[model samples]
Target: MIALIGAAVAPGIAILSYFYLRDSLEPEPISMVIRSFIFGMLLVVPIMVLQYIMQNEWNWRDGIVAEVFQSAVVEEFFKWMVIYFTVYKHLEFDEPYDGIVYAVAVSLGFATLENLFYLIINGTNIAIWRAFLPVSSHALFAVWMGYYLGRAKFSKDAKHERLFLWMSITLPIGLHALYNLIFLAVQNWLVVIVPFMLILWWQGLKKVQRAHDFGSKNLSSRPQ
Candidate 1:
C-alpha cells in the first residue's frame, strides 16, 4: 500500500516540481498552488458524471469516438473548468508563466489520483508505464492549455485574448483526442505514437521557453 501510494504520487510531484521551477521568475504562492491542485482533484466528480451521460447516450462501443470523448474531451474540459473558475483571474496570475504553474498543479493533481486507483487495481508492475504515459501526458496537456490561458489573462487586445482563450480549451481537446485516437488504434503504435510524442514534446517545450521569456520580461520591467 505504501509503495502503491508512492508510485501514484511521485510522478505528479516530479512533474509539478518541473513546472514550478520553470516559473522561477515569479513563483505563485504555495497556498494558491495547493488550492488549484485540490480543486483539480475535485474535477473528477464532474468528469465522471459527464462521461456517464455521454457513454450512455452515445454508446460508441468504446470505439474511436467514445475513446476521444471519454479520455480527451471529458478530462481536458474538467481541467479547463478548474483553471477558468479558480486561478485564471487571480491577482497572482500576473505573468504568463503563472498559468503554467497553476495548470500543471491541476493536471498532476487529477493524474495522481487517477494513477493511485489504477495502480491499486492493476498492481505496481505497470507503475512505470503509468508514470511515463498518463501522468506525464497530463502535464503536456496542461502545457498547451496553460500557455494560452496565461496569455489570455494578461492580454490587452480583445482579439488576442479571444484567440488564446479559445486555444486554451480547444488545443488541448484536439491534441488529446488525436492522442486517444491513435492510442485506441494501437496496431502500428510507433507510426502514430512517435510522431505524436515528438510534436507534443516540441510544442510543450516551445511553450515553456515562451513562458520563461515572458517571465524574464516581467522581471526586467519591474522596479528594483
Candidate 2:
C-alpha cells in the first residue's frame, strides 16, 4: 500500500517540481500551489459524476466521439474552468511562468489522484507506464493551457487576449482528443504514443521557455 501510494504520487511531485522550479523570476506561494492541487483533486468527483451521467446516456462509450467530445472535452473544460476562475486573476499570478506553475499543480493534482485509484485497483505493475503516460500527458496539457492563459491575462490587446483565452481551452482539448483517439483506434498504441509523447514534451518545453523568457522581460521592464 505504501509502495502504491508512493508510485502514484512520485511522478506528480516530480513534474510539479520541474515546472515550479522554472518560475525563477517569481515563485508562487507554496500555499497557493497546494491549494491549486487540492482543487484539482476535488475536480475528480464532479467530473466523474458528469461522466457517469454521460455513460448512462450512452454518450461516453469507448469510441472516437466519446473519447474526444465526451472525455477530453469534459476533462479539459473543467481543468480550464478551475484555472480561469480560481487563480487567473490572483495577484500572485503576476508573471508568465506562474501560470505554468499553478496550472501544473491543478493538473497533476487531478492526475495523481486518478493514478492512485488506478494503481489501487490494478496493482503497481502498471504504475510505471501510468506515470510516464497519463500523468506526464496531463502536465504537458497544462503547459499549453497555462502558456496561453498567462499571455491572455497579461496582454494589453483585447483581440489577442480573446484569442489566447480561447486557445487556452481549445488547444489542450485538441491535443487531449488526439491522445484519446490514438488509444482507442490504434491496435499497437505503444508505438504511436511514444512519438506523440515526444512531440508533446518538445512543445511543452518550448512553451515553458517562452513563458520564462516573458517573465524575464517583464522583470527587466519593471520600475526596478
Candidate 3:
C-alpha cells in the first residue's frame, strides 16, 4: 500500500519540482503555492460530486460527451477556478512564470490524489502508465492554462486580458478532451497517445520558456 501510494505521488512531486524550479528570476511565495495545492486537493470532492451527478442525471458515463464535457471540461474548469480566485490577483503573483508555478502546484495536487485513488482501487499494475499518462498530462495541461493566464494577468489591454483568460480555460479543455478521446476512440491507444503527449510536452516547454522570458523582462523593466 505504501509502495503504491509512493509510486502514485512521486511523479506529481517531481513534475511540480521541475516547474517550480523553472521560475528563475522570482519564485512564487511558497505559502501561495501550497494554498493553491490544497485548494486543488479540495476540488476533487466537488468535482467528483458534479461528475457523478452529470454521469447519472445526463447519462454521460461514456462516449464523446463523457470525455469532453464530463471529464475534461469539468476537471479543467475547476482547476482554473481555483487558480483564478486564489492567487491570480495576489501580490506575490508579480511574475509571469508565477502563473505556471501556481497552476502546476494545483494541478499536481489534484493529479496526485486522483492517482493514489486509482492505484489503490485498481492495484499497482497500472501505476507505471498512470504516472506517464494522467500525472504528466495534468502537468502539461496546467502549463497551457498558466501560459495564457500569465499573459492575462500582465496585459494592459482589457481585451487581451479577457482573451487570454478565455484561452486559459478553453485551450486546456480542448487538449484534455482530445487526450481522453484518444483513449476512448483509438484501438491501439498507446501509439497515438505517446505521440500526442510528445507534442503536448514540446508545446508546453515552449510556453514555459516564453513565460520565463516574460518574467525576466517584466522584472528588469520594473524600477529597482
Compare the candidates by lDDT and give the number of the best one: 2
Displacement of the residue 26 alpha carbon in candidate 1, Å: 0.9
Residue ranges of candidate 2 with Cα displaced over 4 Å: none
Tell me the spans in candidate 3 whose CA falls farther than 4 Å from its real position.
none
Let me know the TM-score candidate 3 reaches against the reference structure.
0.97
Tens digits of lDDT, candidate 3, 1-224: 78988998899989998998888888777787878878888888889899889999878866888899988999999999989988899899898888899999999999989988898899989988999999999999999999999999999899999999999999999999999999899999999999999999999999999998988888888998
lDDT of model number 2 = 0.92
Q: TM-score rank, highest first? A: 3, 2, 1
* Cand. 1 TM to true fold: 0.92
**1-224: candidate 1 lDDT, tens digit per residue:** 99889999999998898788767677788899988888887776677777888788767566877878787888998899889988887788889888888998999899888888899999999999888778888899999999999889877799999999999999999988887778777899768777777788888989999988977787688799
Error of 3 at 122 (Å): 0.7
Candidate 3 local Cα displacement, residue 201, angstroms: 0.9
Instruction: Say which prediction, candidate 1 or candidate 2, comes out ahead on TM-score.
Output: 2
Q: Is candidate 1 or candidate 3 better by lDDT?
A: 3
Candidate structures ordered by lDDT, highest first: 2, 3, 1
Clash pairs, model 1 backbone: none
RMSD of each: 1.8, 1.1, 1.0
The whole-model C-alpha lDDT of candidate 1 against the native structure comes to 0.86
